[model samples]
Target: MADLITAGRAMSRRHLLAVGGALPLLGACARAGLGGGFPAQTVRVSAPFAMPDIAVPDFRGARPFPITTYGASPDDQARTSAAIRMAIAAAHDAGGGMVVVPQGVWPTGPIHLASNVNLHLERGATLLFSDDPHDYLPAVQTSWEGIECFNYSPLVYAFGCDNVAITGPGALVSKLDGWKPWYARPKPHMDALIALYTMARQGVPVAERQMAVGQNNLRPHFIQFNRCTRVLVEDVTIHGSPFWTLHPLLCRDVVIRRIKVRAHGHNNDGVDPEMSQNVLIEDCEFDQGDDAISVKSGRDMDAWRLATPARNIVVRNCRILNGHQLMAVGSELSGGIENVFVDNCHFIGDGKGADGWAVPIDNLLFVKTNERRGGHVRNIHMTNVTATRLRGSVLAVETDVLYQWRTLLPTYVRRLTPIDGLHVANVRVAEAKSVCTIRGEREQPVRNVSLRNVTVEQLSGPAITTDNVEGFRRDG
Candidate 1:
C-alpha cells in the first residue's frame, strides 16, 4: 500500500526564483567556466559574488612579510603551524587581520583556525602536510561520513569561530608516499590505538561524545569547521586527503566556492555539510572516492539527541568527474533534513569503476532513515542535473533493515522511524542498469514521494518499487 500526501511546506518563492535564475548561467559556463581558463586574480579583487570568485583579503594596510625566507623541512611543519597560530593570535590580540602563507613549500601537521583570521596562501605557496600518521594523532571530535566519531584532526580545523576564511590561490598537498597507503595505518599500533579509542568512546555517555574534543580515531578530513558562523573557503586545491575532505558541520552562513578536490583514498568524500543552515556550495570540482556532495546528520541515538535539521542549504554549478555518488543524503539522517536544493550539476560516472563496486550507486538524491533514527526529509528540489552515465538507479529511497540491524541495533535502536515527504523533479539520466527503487519498512511506509519531468533512457527493473509506501506520485 502506497500513500501520497501534500503534507508539508512547499518550496518558497525566493528559492524557486534563485534556482530558475542560476540554471541558465550554469549551462553557459558548463565546460569553459571561470577559473578553467581565466588568469589569476587577487582573492579580494576577484568576483566574490561570482561563481568562481577567489576571495583574497584586502590587507592593504597591514605590514607584509615574505614567506620565501622561511626554510622548508619536515620539522618545519610544527613550526609553520605554530607560527600561523601565533600570527592569528597576535592579529586577534590587536584587533584583526590576515595570516598569510606566502609562496614556498611549507610542511605542516594539524593547523587550527581562529576567529577573524584569514589563512591565505599565495600563488606559489604549497601547504604540504606530513604523511606521518602520528602527526595527526590524539584524535579529536569530528565527523567521518557524517557520523560523529573521534577521528584525526583535519589538515585545517576550526570550531565555534566567527568570520573565518581559508582563502588563496595556492595548492595544499598531502605528502602520501606510494608505499604506504593513505587510508591504512603504517603500523599495527595505530590500528590498535584506533580500536582502543573506539572502545573507550563506547563506554562514554552519548552526550559526552558529542561534546568531546580531539580526533575520534576515525578517518581524517582535509578541512573541517564545526559550530561556526560566517565562514568562507575559496579558490584552493586540496589533494590526497587521507579521508573525507572539506566538511562544515552545524554552521550558518557558510560558503565554499571555487575549490578543487582530488582524492582517491578510501572514503575520501569531496564535501560533506551536516546539520548546517544557509550554506552555499558552488563552482567546485571533485574527483573523489565517495559522494561528491553528501549531506548528513547525527548517527544512531546521537542523531536523536542532536535533533537539528540541515536546512536552507544550496549546491550549484559543480562538476563531478568520478565519485561513488554525485550527491547523497543520509545513511545517517537521525536529525531531520529539509529545504535542500541542488541544481546545474554534472555527474560523469566512472562506468568501469561504477560497475565494479558491490553496492549500487544509490541515487543522486538519496534519503534513507534507519530504524534507530528515523526523521523527515522534505522539500528537496533538483533541477537541470545531467548524468552522462550511471550504473545504478536514477533515484533510490530505501530503509535497509539489515544495515540498520548491523549498524544501529548494537548501539541503540528505536522503532517507528518514518522517512516521509520527498519530492524530486527535473532529473535526467543518459543511461543506467537498474530501476529506481523506492522502498520503506513494512510497518513504517515511505510516504509522499513525487517525481516530475524525470527521463531515463534505460532501466533494468521497475521504474519504482516499494515494500510499503503510502501516497507515492509520479508525473511525466
Candidate 2:
C-alpha cells in the first residue's frame, strides 16, 4: 500500500476497498504525500503533540485532609460546602495534599478549588451541587459562552491557580431542577448578550464588564478552570449540567482522561476547551445535549481582543453516545483554531436495549461559522473511526449558522471564517442521510477538505452536497 500511494496517485471510492480496504492506503497517503482524496495543494498533516506532558500529581507522601474532619458528616442533610472549603484550605496550607471526600452522598454548594490541591472523592461518593443560583454567589471572573463576563460561578471553579486536580470514581451531579428553567434565552439573557457584544466591540475593560451585579441571569458552567495551569481531571463521572459541563478556559497544560459525562441539558457540551492549549482528552465517554466536544476560543470582538487561539489539542479513544455533533468547531471560534487531531474514537447511540446501540448520531464532525466570526480553522485530522445508525451526514461544514444572531445583533465586522486543510480517513457508518454536506459562503469558500476510505452502508440523500468549496475530494 505504501508503494502504491506515491505522489499523485488516484484512487476511487470502490477502488479503495477493492485493494483490501483503505486504512493502509490512507495512512500511506498521509506519509508519502496527498493521494486518494486529498487536495492537490500541499497540506501539512500534524502529528500528536508531545510538549506540555501534564501528569496527575502523586499525593502518596502527602497527608490527606478529610472533609469529615472539617465538620462534614454524611448523617446530616445540610450542605457541606463550608466543610469542603475548609478542608481544601488546610490541604493548600500544608504545602500540597489531598482533600478527601469519603464515601457518602454529600449535597454541597459551589466548590472553589485552590492551587496545589487534589480534590479526590472516594468510591461511592457523590457531590450533589445545589440548584439555587445564590449558592454560587459573588460571581468570579468567568466567561459566558465565548464572551468574557462575571456571571454565576461554575459549580466547581479554579481561577488563576496552578497544579490543580479533580480525581475520583465518584459522581459530581448538578441539581438541575433550578437551572433547567434558566435554559430559555429570555429577554434578560439576550439583553446581556447585546451588552457584552457592545462592550467587547467598544473595547471595554473585562474587569468592568460585569453581569454578576445585575439581573442578566446567564447560567454558569459546571466545572471551569480559568487562567490555571497544569490541570488534570480523571476517573470522575459527571451527571446533568446547567451549561457546558467541563470547560477549561484560558488554561494551559491540561490532561483529562477516563472521565464520563452525561449532561443532556441545554448547551450541555461534555467538554468545551476554550482558549486553552496543549490539552489531551482521551478515554472519555460523552452523552451530551449539544456537541460532545466543542473547541472554542472567544467570540467576535472579544476573541479578537484576547488574541489567543485554541491549538495543539488531541482527542482520541473517546466514545460519543449522543450529541448534536460528535465533535464541532465553532460558531464561537473567532480567535481561530488549529492543529487539532481526533483519532481512534467510537460513535454509538445511547447504550440501551439489547445491543446498546439503539440511539442514532446526528452528525459525526461538524464545522460551523458565520460572517460575524472572522476566525481561521486549519489542520484538522480525524481517522480510524466506526459508527452505526447515523441519521445525518457524516461530515458537515456550514458557514452561515448565525441562529438568531443573524438579526439579533449587527455584524460588527463583515469578515468570514476561513476553513482549510481538513482531513479524515478510514471511517465507516452504517446509515446516514448523506456522506457530507458543505455550505460555505460565496465570500469565503471552504477549502482543502480531504476524505479517504469513508463509507456509509445506506445514504438517504446524495453522496455529497455543496454550495461553495474549493479543493474538496472524497475517495473510498
Clashing pairs in 2: 13-476
Q: For residues 1-476, what per-residue lDDT tens digits would candidate 1 score against the true structure?
A: 00000100111223234335323322221223222222122322111122222222233454433333233343567677666656666554444456778777888877766555567888987888876666764445566544554445677877666656787899888776721343553434243333333433354332223211222234567788877766788899898787668888887677789999887667778888888877778899987777788887756555666778877677889988777677777776767777777888887655544346322244677666666566667666677677766766667776763341363224344554566666667878877654357777888887787778878877766666666888878889
Q: Estimate each model's TM-score.
A: 0.76, 0.86
Candidate 1 weakest ten by summed lDDT: 1-10
* Per-residue lDDT over 242-285 for candidate 2, one digit per residue giving the tens place of the 0 to 100 score: 99999999887788889999888888899999989888899999
lDDT of candidates 1 onward, in order: 0.63, 0.78
Residue 312's lDDT within candidate 2 is 82
- The true-structure Cα RMSD of candidate 1 reads 13.2
Best by TM-score: 2
Q: Which stretches in model 1 have alpha-carbon errors above 4 Å?
A: 1-75, 144-150, 177-217, 349-362, 401-411
